[model samples]
Target chain A: MTRIYNFSAGPSMLPEAVLRRAGEDILDWGGSGMSVMEMSHRGKHFGAIAERAEADLRELLAIPPEYKVLFLQGGATAQFAMVPMNLLRDRTAACYVDTGIWSGKAMEEASRYCQVGVAATAKAGGFTTVPPRSEWRIDSEAAYLHYTSNETINGVEFQDVPDSAGLPLVCDMSSNILSRPVDVSRFGLIYAGAQKNMGPAGITVVIVREDLIGKTIPGTPTVFDYKKHADNGSMLNTPPTYIWYLLGLVLDWLKQQGGVAGIEAQNIRKAQKLYAAIDASAFYSNPIDPAFRSRMNVPFRLADAGLEKIFAAEAAGHGLVALEGHRSVGGLRASIYNAMPEAGVDALIAFMADFERRYG
Target chain B: MTRIYNFSAGPSMLPEAVLRRAGEDILDWGGSGMSVMEMSHRGKHFGAIAERAEADLRELLAIPPEYKVLFLQGGATAQFAMVPMNLLRDRTAACYVDTGIWSGKAMEEASRYCQVGVAATAKAGGFTTVPPRSEWRIDSEAAYLHYTSNETINGVEFQDVPDSAGLPLVCDMSSNILSRPVDVSRFGLIYAGAQKNMGPAGITVVIVREDLIGKTIPGTPTVFDYKKHADNGSMLNTPPTYIWYLLGLVLDWLKQQGGVAGIEAQNIRKAQKLYAAIDASAFYSNPIDPAFRSRMNVPFRLADAGLEKIFAAEAAGHGLVALEGHRSVGGLRASIYNAMPEAGVDALIAFMADFERRYG
Candidate 1:
């Protein structure tokens, strides 16, 4: 069977080893006589799976004792509202940095629950750069300061954690959580959709400092409350059991790859090679500032916009797929996440050089 | 390779055929180089899968043209809040029929948003039966009348839909949605988690009348609003792609098993035989009224309550697992969902008879 190099942003490619192990375990997990999908969330088999996933994640990220890790549903979009709902304890507003479409969506959703303040924005530069920390307006009265570490659509990323101006820092790390190591203590809360660097869709991972929970706004749904989920071990309801199991498999595979530090080194190498190829070519141009270009999603434009479709179509023919950019922005994007091998990037680079030779 | 019978209430057994197919497709789906989990929600491959899933489900249940089917994240627990958040448009109260724990939870959540009037309740009878329709006092002015079609924990189920008393009817069919045929036109909205009769644990299916959407409460998150999801075809954000594909597989398998009506016959025969066996034995008793006993979950008690634990342990040793009841209620429960074959049920009966001969 020929497997392709898939570059779809989220719900993207997973480690081949994880998929192989998952397929083998589909009918009977660890000889339990029941598929992971069939086991009850409360059952001992799944209980062990859940515990190991959390423990491995804690070790990988070095999460502290004061932090509670929650596996929730509704994706990061749900967190857009949940953040304001659970964190806006007696506060009138929250601060958000507008990096791209994702952060903008988060700001809009939070507006429904509380006053949303745009402390910093990259919109003036066409969402190609992050507004520097020095330019950010500090709103100390706001409940927390929020930012998207990586903008999957715009290909903009924060090089380092920005000071939250003394407000508790919250981050949307959906597209880049495990691609690199981070200081968890710098943020009050970090939320991510598991579809990217973790596993598949359906599960959202939330790591929050314990002190920030329990003060949900009056109208928050119990399921949306951090305290309820944390108190119940994310079993306030029957969680996505199979998805949780798959996440566990991915975590196990991540550990085999020498953990986050090991994967992060490879991630940097892959991004640099691809970016260097784009910079060397007159036929291709990436618009984002060199300093803020995302290592996860690299969006670029062909010198002739008409050739962008042909470039993507030909790439798929070579078993390199999903190279098209976001529909909102018509271009070509290659999202090289942790699961993307360096060989895939090298192949894409080789194909680009050949295409340039013919079209240039 | 010893595939045993699993009787989990939800996140229960899946059709072995479905599991086999899922296992095979985990690497490459439909000869595509990428697995379904790797496909973007917007891509043509997953687009076909998603459309066909909705179409097959529509045919299976004979859903009307006016009903919009949504595959969402968060289970029925999320629906408990979403039902009131979206349906309580400009209305200050809603009517709820409290039959068991699930219904009680739904009512408690709804009360957080609006006035919840208990139209009828089986609590007076220890939740052993459904309150007669004649006794229901559904408020005409309330936004909707809500009920639980089957309670997974308490093992109580309604044999037929009750009169809504001139209000839009909302039903949580989480545990027994596809086990039988039902007239969908009668309900304003019906929601079910996919773990029991459908597929796995991450996706929630919402079949809502077209007119019931587009009017959410003031602070409802965009993802929580049915209108937003329905508008985007449940792609308001990246959906649980792999889980949706698995649900599609379950729907396909259900069709092969002769759709809902065919399964309904099997469900009846299985439930009847099990109930008959329980009734014929003086040593075992099901506390739920026979008329309201669930076809999905059969909860029973031993004459010698001390033997309950021993009974469950022995049953597991005989290739029957998860026979222990919910922690909230202490006894034995066999959740024979649609996927639990008749052979499995027959085996269970034989085991029960043997156990009684030795212990009775």
Candidate 2:
């Protein structure tokens, strides 16, 4: 079987080992004689999977005991509204740093629950750069300041999460979560859609401070209500159990890759190699600001606009698939998520070089 | 392989054929050479799967072209909010029938958005019967009336969907969806969680009238916004691709089973045999009123509560799995969904009769 590197942003590539294990266990998970998909959420087997998944995630993230880890549905997009619904009490406005498509979306959703204040925006920079923290206009009385740690579409990433003074800070780390190390204590809430770096597209991981629980707006559905989910071990309703099981496998894979710090070293090298290849060729260019180019998603453009289709086709021939950029932003985006091997990056870089040789 | 007769309530038993097909396609779906779980939501493979799934579903349900089918996440619990958010415009109150746990939860969620008028409640009847429409007190000035077509937890199914007098009717068919034929035009919206009588747990199927497209309260997340999901063909976000694919297979399976009408006939026989066994036995009894007893879920109790554990254990040994009742109401619940064969039900009945003879 010819293995291809998938760079489709999300619902992207998963470790082949994990996939094999999942397929093996699809019909009989860990001697339970039942498929993980067929197991009851309340059953002893699934309950253990859920518990271990949480414990593994906490350990992987070096999460504080004061923070509750929630495995939720509806992805990070759900958390865009849930954050304010659960935290925007006693505050008139919530501040946001608009970096790219994700934070822009976060801003749009947050506006529904609170008076949203744009503390900073990278729009003027064509969403290619993260706004400097010193340039931010934060409201001291804001409930929480929200930002996307990495923008999947524009391939922009924050090198550092901002300090919100005494106020809580929230980050949508959907695209680059678990790709690197971070201090968990700096943020009051951290949410990541599982599709990109975690596992599949169904589960959303939320790490929230204990104090943020039970503050949901009255109109919040019990399912999306953070307190209700947190109170009931994220099983207040039927969770996406299969996806949760897959995530557990991914977490196990992460541990084998020498944890976050070890993965970060590899990620830094991979991103640098890909970026260097793009910068070296006049045929291809990544316009993102030098300081903020995402380590996960790398977006670039061919010098000739018409070659976009040709470039994608050629890449596919070489078994490097899903290299097309976001539709809104036309070009090429190679999403080298945590599951993406260094070999895949090398293959992509080699393809870029070959394409440049013919086109340049 | 000894196949277990799974009687789980919502995340219930899937068709054996569907499970086998799913297992066969676990790694390479439709020759795509990628696990359905690994496919990008926007890729041709998943897009085709999603489109065909919707098309097949539309054909199966005989859904009108004017209606939109949304493959949403978050299950029926999320729909409890999406329904009121989309349909409660210019209406201060909505009518709801309290049939059982699902309807009660829907009412609770709806109450947060609008004043919910109890049209009729079966709770007074110990949640064993569906109140007659003649006993309903629907408000003329109210928004759409809502009810659960079948209560999975209480083993109560509505024999008839009440006429809404030209008003829009919304039904939560979580337990009984695709179990029988129904006129689609009578209801403005129908939502079902895909675990029972459909496919898997991660996906929720929502069929909404096109006219009820965009009336979301400001606080509703764009992900849950009816217009947002509808306009994008349920692809506004990365959907639960694997679950959706599995649903399409299940839908195809239903069509092969001679559609909903044929399945309903089989379901009736299954429920009748189980109910007959319960009623004939002095040691076993089903509390649900006969008039409203569900064809899908049959909840029963032993005359001696002390024997409940023994019954469940012995049933498990006999391969009649997941008969333990919901935590709120402790007893046995055998959910014979569309995929549950009459033979499975017969086995369950036989087990019950033998257990009662030996233990009574």
Candidate 3:
């Protein structure tokens, strides 16, 4: 059977190996004679899967023993509010860098819980670039600083981690997590919606330094409390079991792909190849600055704006799907996340070249 | 191809048909060239799946257009917190009937937001029976009256809907939803985690009266606000797409099974057959009141408690799995949800009879 390369921004592509294993196990996981989806969360089989996934993830990221990895639900959108609810213990104000759609959303949700300080914003540039860290206005007395490590919509990414000046730095790594390795000790908290670079849409991976948990605002919903989930190992409720199982397969796949450092080398090459192709063609242009262009999401525009629909449709016809950009930023986007193979990128680049030859 | 019958309480048995279809489509769903797990929530393919699932569910329940059906994440435990956050509008106290574990958890979470009146409780009876409505001391000035329709852990089911006396009645039908037909008009809200009787663990089915939404307590998390989900069709954030698709397939299967009424007949016969098998044998007994015993979860004890381990081990040896009761209740519990075929129940009864013959 032929397979189309999927480039969905969040609920994007998964490793074919992972999908194949998951398919085989979907009806009866590990010979237990039950689908993973049908297994009880408290059951020993799923418990082993959950534990192994966590251990694999911790090994992958070199997560400090002091940090807890929580497999949660409601995606990263829940974390937008949860971060403020749980982290804003005594301080009433928090700092944020408004890079693009994801962080902008986090800022809006957080305003309800505490006073929000837009320490830096790239909105003036139509969110096409990240503001230089030196220009950021941070409140020393604020609770914590938050930012999105990569903006999925605008295709902007951080060239270097922003300094919160000794304060806890919380990052929304929803779109770029596990694509590369970084120092875990630099941030107090990191969260990612599992749909993009991880696995599926139903789960969120929250890595929080132990000290930041268990101190949420009074009246905070128990489901959003970091302490409750961390304390219970994210089994405070029935977790998204099937998705959690899929994530384990994904972690295993990542390990086979040579861990984060190995994947980072491949990702760097893929992004460079795609970006070079875009830059070489006058027919297509990515307006984002070179320093901050996203390694995952790559949005480009045809010189002739009206041709966007035809471009998207033809791409789908050619077995390249979800090539349409976010409506908020209209054009064509190909999200080459961790699951995306170099072969898919080459195919997309080849298609872009062919399309330019036909149109130009 | 030997298959084991799984009797897990939640995340329990699913129809073999559903599992087979899901496994077939695990790599590519509906010939869409991608798995349902890989589809974007906002895309037409997933949108169609979501709309169709909602429509099928509505048709099965004969839900009023005046009521809103929300496909949410975070399971029923999240609802234990969200129900009060959203439903306790302008009211300081909500009345709850404490039947078992789930309802007790709900009251504990709700108390964090508003005063909770325990109108009635079955803890006095070891939670083996539901208290009569006449004995409930409901607060007329309260927000809404809440109860668990079927306590999965306790093996107690409400035979009839209790009077709310003009108060909006909310029911946690997590274990027993769609097992039988009920009057939706009588309930202001009905929420169920989808692991049992529905589809999977990641998605929750919340059907609420249109008038009861939009007035959540201040500082309510956006994801917790029922109105946002109702207005946006439960796409407030990315939904659990794979689970949603499975729920649609389940709804389709339900319609083919002659809807709720047809299934209720089968469910009754199954429950009666199993209960009879346990009651007639000196080797086994169910302590729940005959009238109030749950048709879904049938918890029983062996005559000799020491034989419980051997009974469970022997059952598993014979391909019956997950029959161990909840830790809170140390007994054997079989959750025969809608997906549990009558033939499977027959197999269980057969096993019990044979075990008794050997050990009695």
Candidate that would win on TM-score: 1
Show pairs that collide, candidate 1. none
Interface RMSD for each of the candidates: 0.7, 1.8, 1.1
Q: Compute the lDDT for candidate 1.
A: 0.94
How does model 1 score on DockQ? 0.87
* Colliding residue pairs in candidate 2: none
Q: What is the TM-score of chain A alone in each candidate?
A: 0.99, 0.98, 0.99
- Model 1 lDDT at residue B305: 92
lDDT (10s digit) by residue, model 3, range B223-266? 88899888888998898888899989888898889999999999
User: What does the lDDT read for residue B19 in candidate 2?
Assistant: 74
Question: Which is the better candidate, 2 or 3, if ranked by lDDT?
Answer: 3
Best by DockQ: 1
Q: What DockQ would you assign to candidate 2?
A: 0.55
Which sections of candidate 1 miss by over 4 Å?
none
**Candidate 1 CAPRI assessment class:** high
Tens digits of lDDT, candidate 3, A52-92: 99999999999999999999999888999999999999999
| Model 3, residue pairs in steric clash | none
Q: Which of the two, 1 or 2, has more lDDT?
A: 1
Where is model 2 more than 4 Å wrong at Cα? none
Candidate 1 per-residue C-alpha lDDT over A1-360 given as tens digits, one digit per residue, 9 for 90 to 100: 899999899889999999999999988999999999999899899999999999999999999999999999999999999999999999999999999999999999999888999999889889999887889897889999999999999999998999987999999999999999999999999999999899999899999999999998877888899999999999999999988988999999999989999999999999999999999988999999999999999999999999999999999999899999999998999999999989999999999999999887
Candidate 1 residues B86-186, lDDT tens each? 99999999999999999999999999999999999899888999988988887888999999999999999999988887789999999999999999999
